[model samples]
Target: MKRLIARALRRLGWLRYDLLISPVAQHPGKNAVPPGELWLVIDTGVKKWACMSCPGGCGVQIALSLNPDRRPRWSVETDFWGRPTVSPSIHQHRACSCHFWVKKGVIEWCR
Candidate 1:
């Protein structure tokens, strides 16, 4: 019964972005990344990476770098409540081809 209810909720766009700060180096696959939640990994007070599952429901984990020194890196900004807002946009050139922006805990899909 609970499983069915959870599925229904997920289908109803229950996705919301949440923040998580981790110390050790880790990959998104090494963690349980639910839908609609973006994991922002911070190492030594510096935001290093952001990751989340594909909002397209393809189950693909998208990992983005936050290092400014690195080319093609995304930046994460957190509001007073700790909600995350990502800059530019995420373009998945892979099979899923999912492109979207996470602004203030909302996913904005690009046309």
Candidate 2:
């Protein structure tokens, strides 16, 4: 099955996610984010938001607030290799309800 193959590829470290930084303050359009890429929005040197397409294969875009002053905000840290680690798991309350954590560019799906 495709899911099994994907898991195998992940285990073999062939599959990994990437982070892309954008200085534009506006929200990314539906097709702006490519698969396996997370976009970080920065405005005037302030971290604004993180955007990415849903990993659940539903093609929905998810945006999380990066401002520490806002409630339910998430923080992102990157290693020397530019691999990102996001604190606190991301849980989609609607849609496919996919929940996961991004650590070092790897998605750890939550059950």
Best by the TM-score measure:
2
What is the alpha-carbon lDDT for the whole of candidate 1? 0.71
| lDDT of candidate 1 over 1-111, digit per residue (tens) | 533454465468673443322223555666667765677777777878888877787777788998999989999886644557888899987778998888866778999
The segments of candidate 1 whose C-alpha lies over 4 angstroms from its true place after superposition are 1-25, 30-32
- Tens-digit per-residue lDDT, 14-74, candidate 2: 8554443333567686655777667778888887888888888887888889999999999
* Candidate 1 local lDDT, residue 102: 81
Best by lDDT: 2
Candidate 1 — which pairs collide?
A: none
lDDT of each: 0.71, 0.75
TM values, all candidates: 0.73, 0.75
- Give the per-residue Cα lDDT of candidate 2 at 84: 65
RMSD of 2: 6.7
